[model samples]
Target: AQSVTQPDIHITVSEGASLELRCNYSYGATPYLFWYVQSPGQGLQLLLKYFSGDTLVQSIKGFEAEFKRSQSSFNLRKPSVHWSDAAEYFCAVGGDGNNRLAFGKGNQVVVIP
Candidate 1:
């Protein structure tokens, strides 16, 4: 079975400061990792994903993630976080051929001025 773990449950970052969220997975084969962000009353929005090819992947809103197979980690980062970036971020792992995914508990980000 595949599972995702986000060590940090809550994170505080100052506006315009860099932010990074850690995600670690447990799976037998190569896994598909994803980062999703959800605002206060909004649904989960895809931030970035890693399937294959490149180790570093970028997505909308200046968010990027790197897939480190050697460490079984896929961490998400933003060079400069905005106030709008405050949300709950989730890390998910899929690609088991069953189209199922295991998600982490999530990290709640609080952006302060």
Candidate 2:
């Protein structure tokens, strides 16, 4: 069985502050991991992914994450989050194919100015 769980359902942070979102997964083998962001009433955008190489992976919008095999976790982090960074974040895992993706419910991020 393969599945993903994000403990936090929502998070609020002040602009220009560090941010970290947690993600946990349950899978039999090494799995393809991904982090996606979606703004209110918008589609998902890929933040980053961990397939096989180095544990740390960087994304487009100044975001990065580390894949911890032992913890069965792939948590996302940003040094200084921007107001534009406020959005819903989802952690996903896929293997068999790209056809389907199992997504965590999502963690809504609110940025206070």
Candidate 3:
């Protein structure tokens, strides 16, 4: 069984500050990891993914994430966040040959000016 845990349910950030959303996973073996963003009324958008090869991958909207197998963590980071970045962020884990993804509850981001 694979699961995702996002410790922070809500986050507040300044308009130009950097951000990091933590994500942890539990799985029997190596699993696929992904980050998705959803706006107020929009569908989920893929931010980035980690399938194999290098642990670090670049994502859309100046976002990036690193996969740490030893720590069982895949954290999302943004060098500088904008007001437009305010939304619900999700972390999901799939693979395992089941074609299923187990997602975290999500992190609600609020950008303050």
lDDT for each of the candidates?
Answer: 0.94, 0.91, 0.95
Every model's TM-score:
0.97, 0.94, 0.97
> Residue-wise lDDT of candidate 1 within 1-113, one digit each (tens)?
89999997999999999999999999999899999989998999888989899999998689999999999999999999999999999999998585898999999999999
Tens-place lDDT per residue, model 3, 10-111, is 999999999999999998887899999999999999999999999999975899999999999999999899999999999999976867899999999999
Show how many residue pairs clash in every candidate, following the order shown: 0, 0, 0
Mark the regions of model 3 whose C-alpha exceeds 4 Å error after superposition.
Answer: none
Residue-level lDDT tens digits of model 2 in 16-86: 99999999998777789999999988899888999999999998789999999999999999999999998
Residue 54 accuracy (lDDT) in model 3: 96
Q: Which RMSD values do the candidates have, in order?
A: 0.8, 1.3, 0.7
The superposed Cα distance between candidate 3 and the true structure at residue 16, in angstroms, equals 0.7
